[model samples]
Target: MSTATLINLVRNGGYQVRRRAVLTSRLLQDEKRPTAACYSSTSERRASRFDPDGSGRPTTWDTFGIWDNRIDEPILLPPSIKYGKPIPKVSLANVGCASHIGKRKENEDRFDYAQLTEDILYFAVYDGHGGAAAADFCDKYMEKYIKEFLAEEENLENVLNKAFLEINKAYERHAHLSADATLMNSGTTATVALLRDGIELVVASVGDSRALLCRKGKAMKLTIDHTPERKEEKDRIRKCGGFVAWNSLGQPHVNGRLAMTRSIGDLDLKNSGVIAQPETKRVQVKKGLLNRDSNIRTKGHHRYLMQVALPT
Candidate 1:
């Protein structure tokens, strides 16, 4: 009758009838305390349906779980990209898990790629809204666009911008067919980080999904949340004939629905002139005497020094 015992029984798929009987008996007995605990145990069992072993090992049911074990894969570099002198050691980790709440079977969030260089580490988080079509498409094609842009473009900033634009165009192309109509209204929030020289960092974002940079023993945000409550965001929404409304929590949102002002895809919103484009910003990690002067203190001097810049 204990929670742990009930969980074990559920995981082994042997307690469904017993669990129902216990709940029914508790309800009929009018036992409030026992009934509440029974309901709580039932909820826990339902939540753990995918991981019957209770090992915290993610199954395919957990959308964000896709990256859990795959982070161990060896890094493969493109032959065309050259490594810079004094290459820095690099490592990357990513994990995406489905939201515990909301309807099951749909993973609104998508992550496409993770890349690291001597000078930069790139990662992206995409939160899809409306449906999975646009999000899945971005998950499939966004990295390819970035790689291709990098191949032809030298400047990192320009390459990143063009990559996003190309992704938008590709989504639009796919949306032309009636069969792919779901993609027309589906969109996602994107947040990306580019760590440069292991010191300077650049973050680009669209919509409300966030990116946080922990630097110098403190959490520093690199990108602003483009929400409808902000004056600029509100103005843009109004210009597109969209209205903003506050939620029960007093948070302003676009058309009383979405919180972000920009996103990729969401063809229905875009058709109303609300184009979703990423906002990009760069941060410099100063070193040497400049570090002390700029208030960018560090734990150790040697640790703050640039180790190496890997060739791209």
Candidate 2:
């Protein structure tokens, strides 16, 4: 059987959030507190969760002592291995993640991966623009939505498509309830991939975050950027009475606004042809063709790298 690995790269920076989607409300509200007050403890200084040093490890979710839901460990797969299911094993030692704040005040990108079912591995990267709220929303709920849809759907592409649209709608409702009009403008790019039965690979994406597969020393792109640069996307925007305008940076944006034609949580741009429907691609992994010599890398703002090891 072929083994697949995943790497997530966020445009601004990429970090893992171990918390569930239900915490979105509380987490957003907590952002208003002072930097010091954000920390859960005031006594001893806690080491950074990403630090390689083993000293001063955090004992609770408050370990980061920051408003962001950053966690060092990956959310692990369920006990499917014990049930005798043949699935690809991702080694903690071989998987690593990194992020940088850049010139921005905070990282607006989010990425994560998990084993959704005994036969499925999930990976995703989200890039937030206007605000991190949209990115944060997608980060927390995208997987959950996919998992839920998977229970009734057999097609990965269909599941991903539904997940994106549903998440966008949910974010709109969330913003409305919060009474935050600004959130209506918040939006994010989503790139999600699923590996099932250690061979079937399906990827769905909206916006520009990209997924690349490296096999036999050659790199293959798995998704396209959903921007005005694409003829169909630009045409859709114009048909919806939206104009594509270029900024001083020479980048094309929809309606003189969002750079990507499709995204999640850009409720304000919905009428302008910016929809959350994702373009999907499916590939079948051949045994021995994808092994330790192969790797998968995804990018948004920052890069997350993954290495794969498959037995011959």
Candidate 3:
């Protein structure tokens, strides 16, 4: 697909959450290819202003927590019982991220990727609607909650499940304390991925933000969108005393309101089957893929695009 078409898809509410591309020597020779940074579909494309330092330039990389070089050490695991292949070390330096404000008056999307521990890496995206409050809250507290839950939970899946529910409750308390009634209606899509032991990838998601992995030039989807158009989601909403209605755009919505059936906030729809619980999935990265050059990038709204190309 053309890069412009991909950006439009994201702007139209379908995110290309995660993309992995393996760069062969031949692909690297193509100097005409764009860098991982974003370009606008219009004539006035500008660089993202996510500069962490006052360098007067767009940021290239951000280490969210204390930088630990030892975190780059690859895990030494015996050959997997099922695959009989040894896990390979993966470098965090190969990861890249970027974001743009898009067409919105204010950007409501928030994203963060960091080393959660010596053995785990965390990546998350929160797309807020109704307001930026929900997305902001997740951006600040999602990693904190995940780390806190990790102290008690051994399974990454359970850690994410608990973290999502806790974050919803925590946001409710925060809103209640702020005495802001409108905050209850604010909501965000949450898509989180955890990499453990360099090979296991566990993802938890609610709403429509997606995660995709490209292996050998093929796309592997990691999460499902939770929208009212889904039969299961629609049935659950109706079972919970809610009705689905289509808008002028022919898009299904819950009670003619939220387009998504599950989210982090949107407390007003809780009784109508809108939920904070996330569906989880787990996959293992092939050691061979990790040994090659890989790329990861996240999308904001269609008006904005971010790409991070990791050169081998």
Q: After superposition, how far is residue 155 of candidate 1 from its true place, in Å?
A: 2.7
lDDT of each: 0.59, 0.75, 0.75
Q: Rank the candidates by lDDT, best first.
A: 3, 2, 1
lDDT of 1 by residue, 1-312 (tens): 999998997876756777888978876665343424334454343434466444345666533443332323233333112332122233443222233324546656655435644445666667777887777777788777777876677666776778777898888888886585677778877666565544455667777665554445465655677777668878878887888889999987777766677888877777444565677877654432222112211111011111112212
What's model 3's lDDT at 162? 97
Candidate 1 vs candidate 3: the TM-score winner is 3
Candidate 2, after superposition: displacement of residue 239 in Å?
0.3
- Over 4 Å off in model 2, which ranges? 1-93, 289-293, 302-312
Kindly list the per-residue Cα lDDT of model 3 for residues 1-312, writing each as its tens digit: 999998888876533233213344435555555554554657533443454443334555353232311233344454333345445454556565656675678878887888898778888888899898999999999999999999989999999999999999999899889878889889999888888766678989998877776555665777878999799999999999999999999999999999999999998999999999999999876653244324443443332222322222
Query: In model 1, which range of ten residues has the least summed lDDT?
Result: 297-306
- lDDT digits (tens) for residues 2-34 of candidate 2: 232233333223343424444665666656644
lDDT of 3: 0.75
Model 1 C-alpha lDDT versus the unseen true structure? 0.59
TM-score, predicted candidate 3 vs. hidden true structure: 0.69
